[model samples]
Target: MTLSKKIEHLEQVLNQPAENFANSFKSDIILFFDDNFSENNTQLFFLNDLNSKEEIQSWVEILTSRFVMKFEAEFEAENDFINDYLENG
Candidate 1:
């Protein structure tokens, strides 16, 4: 998938109702990065002007590792959501 499509997928996942624990966990990841990278509600600064697949993957990898490390217990139950979000792109 293209970067744009991946972003769209993220939005799709986030739009789902957080009625269950699994969906809520996915929302947490999406919301964290969305707020973390937001600047006046614009594109994510680090993700903006990306030029290659490696750069995108690297960014995702770094973010995923850091996020997982910071929230290991919560991430353990829904690791695949992050993996799919990053890798499917």
Candidate 2:
């Protein structure tokens, strides 16, 4: 079916509630809404927020550092220590 027809069908089936649906996508978060339609539009809003980035960076730094220390202790630099440690674990 055509897109418009499908949307219309959804409206009928759902009884058309005036609300927004929002969610996150890994690095991006979005909210679906329509202001111009003043009716209903399935729109996407990407959120560029610092909190998520900070948290992710913090996790990576924490995990990588923890792994690196164990790696260095177990294998010397002459070996492919870093790569091998990660791959083996």
Candidate 3:
């Protein structure tokens, strides 16, 4: 798949509900990267031809940072809800 298509797929996967936050999210993200690079040699070649290692690393870092922020926000929201419930109940 093209880079845009891969990104689109990633966004779709990210939007899906995770059954278990830790296992499901980690595995799904890993699987997405693995399938794109390892299983699809063409995509690996395309990336190599189009971008340098640093550029690719930067992209990965950006995505990772975004995921971290999202996870932190979700965790905080859940924690707040639980605390409020305990206090009120």
Best prediction by lDDT: 1
* lDDT per residue as tens, model 3, 53-86: 4554444444444444454653455334323322
TM-score of each candidate structure, all chains considered together: 0.36, 0.23, 0.35
Q: Taking the tens digit of each residue's C-alpha lDDT, what string does model 1 give over 1-89?
A: 45564454445545657564434454556665563323443444334445555555455445455554544665464445455444554
Error of 2 at 20 (Å): 44
Measured on C-alpha atoms, candidate 3 has an lDDT of 0.43
**1-89 in candidate 2: lDDT tens per residue?**
43444444322323333243311111111011221212234321111121343443443344345443454544454134323533442
Candidate 2 Cα misplacement greater than 4 A, ranges: 1-51, 72-89
lDDT score for residue 85 of model 1: 48
Model 3, 54: alpha-carbon shift in Å?
0.2
For all candidates in order, the CA lDDT equals 0.50, 0.30, 0.43
Clashing pairs in 1: none
